[model samples]
Target: MKKVLIVGGVAGGASTATRLRRLNENLEIVLLEKGQHVSFANCGLPYHISGVIENRESLLVQTPEKLKKRFNIDVRINSEVISVDSSNKKVVIRNNGEEYTETFDYLVLAPGAKPLVPPIEGIHGNNIYTLRNVTDLDKIMEKLKEKSIKDAIVIGGGFIGIEAAENLQEKGVNTTIIEAAPSILVPFDSEISNLLEVELMSNGVNLLTNNKVIKFEEKNERVVISLENGNKVEGDMVILAIGVTPDTNFLKNSGINLGERGHILVNDSLETNIKDIYALGDAILVKHFVTGQDVSIALAGPANRQGRIVADNIMKKGKTYKGSFGTSVIKVFSLTGASTGLNERSIKVLGKKYEKMYLHPNDHANYYPGATPISIKLLYEKESKKVLGAQAVGVKGADKFIDVIATVLKFRGTIEDLSELDLAYAPPYSSAKSPVNMSGFIGENIEDNLVEQIFVENLKDFDKDKNIILDVREEFEVVVGQFEHSINIPLGQLRERYNELPKDKEIWAYCAVGLRGYIAYRFLTSLGYKVKNIAGGFKSKLKI
Candidate 1:
């Protein structure tokens, strides 16, 4: 009988063991973990912090006894794999200070990752914690239950940082985020960062960007963070969600190929350089679905999928794993932000020819009681018009937009194809032309040059006098605001008073959103006037 030993028992390891057992009853499967709990709901840890999840036991997916009894798989907790002997196919498993060797025909490594703990003075203070697993959750809960945590300072603005800040706010704690980068959510473009900042600030969460902590000092039950910018901030508790690094230090000299930062290098089938040895999840690097380069993406969704793939390939099913898009969605209180495939930064780094369009569309029909506007930015190949990526933020239905784009990206769908898709629609749920279809429809127009376009963010550098910047909103609507030196010509009066505007100069039109501006652009372009409409019109000021 073939023996399979899996190290680490989170999304990847547990999945591999359970799937392996289901595929072959005769196979010997051993699952070991270095932590007290295995197969817990890690992603739900943040919700539990705010008492949204309520019960701690609900987070536990399975116990060692349950896993073994249900699947007949040998399970061990607090068993750390100290070393790997690839030549002999053996591993040193240490448990309770006892060392033992386990032999295996195949080995899978899902050591996962730990939050990066920088070496700062007083960082080991009792109040500072990093959330990663069930153990970390209990420690945090203990402090919260004992009334030890009051004001919180979360370092970093990535996924964990943002989630922690939001949940802390839910508990009525004064929380502030210290982001080292110029913006939070570095993986996304400025649009998402802009929206996230608004969401956080409006909800009374203080945010400080471009600030790095140089040192930490413990002072009378409070922690002080010294910033490189010569500022100091104090908090009753500090949570470091800076980021994660692969928990694979033991494998450094194990002859397994690792990337520059200690990421295990694996192939399409999730196999390492050593034969009969595989690695998946947060510790290993896999091919990017679109970029065709190796990247370490640490999302539970991809990790779970990787676990299933490893199980199939180990069973000799001849199945190959495709890459991941890193598609993700996060709810920041009431607002939601999501993105799929490559962002602007990734596209620029890859040096590809791409064009981007920004549009603001209502999530549902305007007549609906609770229709909300969504800000969407779509990126595509300049020549082929292939949709590269998309990002959306709104109070509702934002995740749906990104999810649709991600599905289309799996097949390299083009702008025309996306526009032609027949989506379900209703007055309450969506308009006849859904936001997703509207993006594609707008993209088709931009590609065909049916309407010339310029984006609002470029207005800072644009010469107002050189071009006629026309605000096509009704004259009364201009009372709220309008670009300086822009002429007001309502859409209804545009055709009747066309001669009042200068035809010799270039003209840019804008409205509440892009719809009215687009209508004006079509009208003026047919009359043979040099006219373009702002992609996202005057109402997009909120995003900026």
Candidate 2:
């Protein structure tokens, strides 16, 4: 019988082991885990701190004994793979201070990633913690119970850090998130991400952007974070949720090709450079589904799928993983943010000729109670008209919008395909024209040259003397705010006052959102006036 030895018993390793057993009952599968728990919901770790996930046992997806009986696979916890001898197809493992060698016909490495704890002064304080697994969660839980966590500081603004801060605040603890970037949730473009930032601040979560911690020191029984800008913040506890690095140090001399950041280099089959060796999960480099560039996306969805693919190839079933789309969604307090494919910043960096448009639509029907606005941004290749990426932010419907785009990306579909998708609709669930459909319609218009649009970021490029900024919103709405040097002309009064507007200069029109502005754009264009709707209108301008 063929034997498969797997290292790391989380999403990728656990899936591979059970899958191997399912494919062939006679196969020998040995799964080694460095941690005590073989498989647990690492994503639910933060929710546990907030008591949202009250039952700790519920997080453990499977136990070693359970796997042994159900899948007939040998599961060993606390057995750390110390080194890999790829040439000999063997691994050195340490368990309870005892070393042993495990030889296998096939070896799968799925050692995921470890929390990146920077080497800074006083970082080793007892109150400083990094959550990665059940062990890490246990320590944090114990600290919460053992001490009074009055104020907490999260030293990152990514998914884990944001989630941790939200949960901490739910526990009635004052939480502050310190991020080095200009904004949080880097996956979403700045305008969309800013909406989330506003939500965080409104919910009593202190957020500090464009800041980094220089050092840590314990003062008055609290951790003092000294910022690089010479500011100090005191907190009872500090979470080092900065980021993660591939946990591939043991394979340094194992002859496996690794990326610059130590991510294992693997082919489409999940096969490493070494013969009979495979790698999957966050520790491996994968091609970007849209960009076709080698990148590292530490997402659970792709890792889970990659696990099944690796098992299929091991059984000689022939499966190929084209790439990962980096599709992700996060709930930050009341607002949710989601994105898939490339953002505008990335498109610019790649020097791709792209066109983008933005829209503000209700998550559901305006007639329905409790309707909230969703900010949607779509990016596509100008030449191919192919949908490159999209982002959505709102109280709800973010996941739905991004999921649709992610599916379209999988089929390499174009913007027109999005418009033609017959999505289900109900007053409480979605608008008559779903946000997805609205985005498609808008894209189709741009593609067909029905109307031209300009973004607020490039408003300065329009010469003041040569271009007229027209606000199509009602006078009452303009009381709240209006763009600088913009003229107000309500859509209802545009027909009677069309002649009053300048016919020589270009007309840049906007409203509360894009619908009215779009209407004005078409009405003016028919009368032979140069007109362009500012994307997303005043709502998007507010975010910037």
Candidate 3:
């Protein structure tokens, strides 16, 4: 019988062990976990703290006792694998101060990652937490029970930081987020992140952008965090959510090829350098879905998928990992934001030529009673026309649109494929033309050279000496807000008042959204007038 020893028992290891057992009934499988709980939903920790989850036991997926009873696998908790001896195919395991060596015919490493704790002064003080596992959650919850927390300082503006801040605020803590970057959610385009930033501010989050914490000081039973920007923020508690590094330090001399970020380098089959050895999850580097570059997304979904692939490959199933798409979504107050594939920041770094179009469409038919506006951005290669990425923000259905586009991106589908998708439509759910399809329609127009469009970022530096900015929205819409030095000319009145405009000057037409501006552009362009539609429309992009 072939004995398989798997280290770590969270999402990656647990899934791999369970699936592998099902594949081979006679294979001896032993799962080792350093943590007290074998499988638990770490992502739900923040929600539990906010009383949203309401039950602590609900987080447990399959405990070690349950796994042993059901799968007949040797499941051990508090058994930490200390070192690997590839020469004899053995691993040193430590449990309750006792050490033992275990030999295996095949080994899998799914140790996952550890949260990064910035080396700042006084960081080791009381109640400073980094929630990565069940133990961390228990420790933080224990502190909250001991004393009332007045305020919390969350370092880093990524997913964990934002979620923790939101949940902590819900628990009556005056929350603040300090991000070193210029903005939060570094994965998304910074320009597109503007909507989320505004939403955070309006919801009473004290966000300190472009700031770094240099040191921490404890005084009068409180923590004083000093920033590199010469500002000090005093809070009762602190949570370090900067990010995480792969938990593969023990594999340093284990003959494993690690990436630049210390992630175990594995091929498409999730096999390491050594034979009969495999690694997956946050600790392994996977190819980027769009870029095909080695990257560590460190997300739960990718980790689970990699686990299944590892199991299949071990059984000679030959299932390969396509790549990590990095498709993810987050809820901020009433708004939800989602994205997939590579953003402009990443595409530009690779010097890839790509074009983008923006649309502000309702989640459902506008005539529908509970329709909400959704902002969608689509990016595609200028030459190949392949869909590169998308970002969306709205109260409803933002995730659905992004998920639909993400599926198309997985197949290297082009902008035309997006428009051709047979999506379901109804007044309560979607429109005759879904927001995603509308984005495709506009993308097709751009791809086909049917419309000339300019982005707002370029419009600032545009040559104001000649090109005119024209607003094509209704007069009432302009009264609320208008572009600088823009001429108000409704699209409906453009045909009758064609004689009022200069014929030789270039015109830039923009409406509330891009629809009316596109109409005005098509109308004026056919009349021998050089015209361009400002992308994303005015009111939607400018935050009405």
Q: Model 3: how far is 244 from its true place, Å?
A: 0.5
Alpha-carbon local distance difference test for all models: 0.88, 0.92, 0.88
User: Which model scores highest in lDDT?
Assistant: 2
- What does the lDDT read for residue 103 in candidate 3? 98
Candidate 1, residues 1-544: lDDT per residue as tens digits? 9999999998999988888988889999999999999899888899999989999999999899999899998889999999998888999999999999999999999999999998877778778999999999888778777566678999999988999899998998899999998889966787666887889999999999989999898888888999999999999888899999999998977899999989999988899999889999999988888888888899999988889989998988866678888899888989999999989888999999988877777888999899998888889888888889988889888899999999999999988878888888989888898887887888888888888788777677567556888899998999999976688989999889988887787888899888899999998888888888887788666354
Alpha carbon deviation, residue 176, candidate 2 (Å)? 0.7
| Residue range 314-418, candidate 2, lDDT tens digits | 999989999998999999888889999999999999999999988888889999999998888899999998999999988889899999999999999888898
2 against 3, candidate with superior lDDT: 2
List runs of model 1 lying over 4 Å from the truth.
542-544
Name the better of 1 and 3 by TM-score: 3
- Native-to-model Cα distance after best TM-score fit, residue 111 in candidate 3, in Å: 0.3
Question: What count of clashes does model 2 give?
Answer: 0
Cα lDDT over the full model 2: 0.92
lDDT of 3 by residue, 145-190 (tens): 7565788889989988988888887887899999999889977787
Model 2, TM vs. native: 0.98
TM-scores of all predicted structures: 0.97, 0.98, 0.98
Clashing pairs in 3: none
